[model samples]
Target: MRLALSGVSVRIDSSPIVAECDLTVEDGERVGLVGPNGSGKTSLLRTVYRALDPFAGSVALSGDDVTTLSQREVARRAALVAQDSTPDFDFTVEEVVAMGRGPWLRAFESTTGGGDATITAALERVRLADHRARRLSTLSGGERQRALVARALAQESPLLLLDEPTNHLDVHAALELLELVKDLERATLCVLHDLNLAAAYCDRIYVLHGGRIVADGPPAEVLDPELVRTVFGVTCTHLTHPVTGGLLLAFSPQQPVRSPHSVKG
Candidate 1:
């Protein structure tokens, strides 16, 4: 699936949260959205899955306007793994993953045999099949996140939207989760706070600042040190990873503010 957001704006009550943000994730491509805190990355992601409607502009999935589709139809096209989406109730992992099949079943109808197969496959993909019988509350943070991803995978959608999926995870768990996401090969748009992870996993990136998209391109071109300093209010030294040969960002506390266009040469 191809996701296209044009002139999108979002508001909470009367206050604007996102403003005229335009971005895209092509079919089977992984795109990243990066920004400082309160920069509206989550708000922009909500618009894609219709959790929050855009007060202005349009969001389209594969040339069809999202507004024109019913909520169930939207779920059929896109699956979202939102930040902190775990249920408060102590549902078993299998039961939690079964929730993803809701769109395919009629109200009050039980899941078909095929749905069970899909749920099993999803749990396997996330490496949580052995834990399916366990209550969600017994799992660790990383395990819980993987369970949520299994739920999303069970939805069988072409497009995936992830909002800060690595928030509370340790270093090993974060890398494992991202590796799983990358291997899925779906059309994915992820909001990530860690610039180095985004640079390593995402094929392209969009930089958001003050509720608008300020810069976008491949990671190499978009993650310039000046751009990082300007948007994130920190000094960054760009480096290459010795093992993976990918972009690595070394950040320091905020330095004297400099204009993004300032040239040292």
Candidate 2:
């Protein structure tokens, strides 16, 4: 299914957070959302997932308006792995993953054998099958994040929304997670703090700044040094990665790196 935000805006206490944003991700596309801190990436994602309502405009999936759908209907359409997910109770990883099936389950109903198979498959996809018996509180930061991802995968939605899914991962795990997303046969909208990772995995990108989308294009066109400086207030150099052949961003310590091809305008 296609995911789209058409001139969507959100406000809290009369202050706008997401302002007239419009973006589209075709089926099976991996689209990245990147911006500096507090740029409303999460807020926009919340609108898409129905956690927040848009003050103006709408979020639509496959020509159907999301606001009109019931919560269960929306849950069946979009699965979200939020930026900050913490389990308060001491639930086992298997139990936590099983929660993803809640939308499809009737009240007082238990997980069936088929549900168990799906949960296990999700955990295995994230390479966390060995930790299924562990308690949520016992897992490390990266492990917890992967468990959350497994839960999202178990939802089995055609559209997936993720907020900094690699927040606490080491270099290897981070890249591996990106690879998993890249290989998935679903439309994915991911908010990534690491520009290089987004460039490496995403087929296209939308650059948000100050509550609005300022740039949208392929990685090579959108991640230029001048645009990064203007939007992120950082000085950086861009190079092509040897292994992946994707754009690699290298930062300057005290001074901005100047290159002729660097569009600073």
Model 2 lDDT tens row, 89-208: 888888888888888888898864444888999989988889888899998777888788888888988998989999978998787777777777689999999998888888999999
TM-score of each: 0.94, 0.92
lDDT of 1 by residue, 1-265 (tens): 8999999999999899989988999999999999999999999999888889999999999999999999999999999999879988999999889888888888888753434899999999999989988999999999999999999999999999999999999999999999999999999999999999999999999999998899999999999989998898888898889999988889999856589789677
Runs with alpha carbons beyond 4 Å of true place in candidate 2: 112-115, 253-265
How many pairs collide in each candidate, listed in order? 0, 0
Compute the lDDT for candidate 1: 0.93
lDDT of 2 at 161: 91
Question: Top TM-score: which candidate number?
Answer: 1
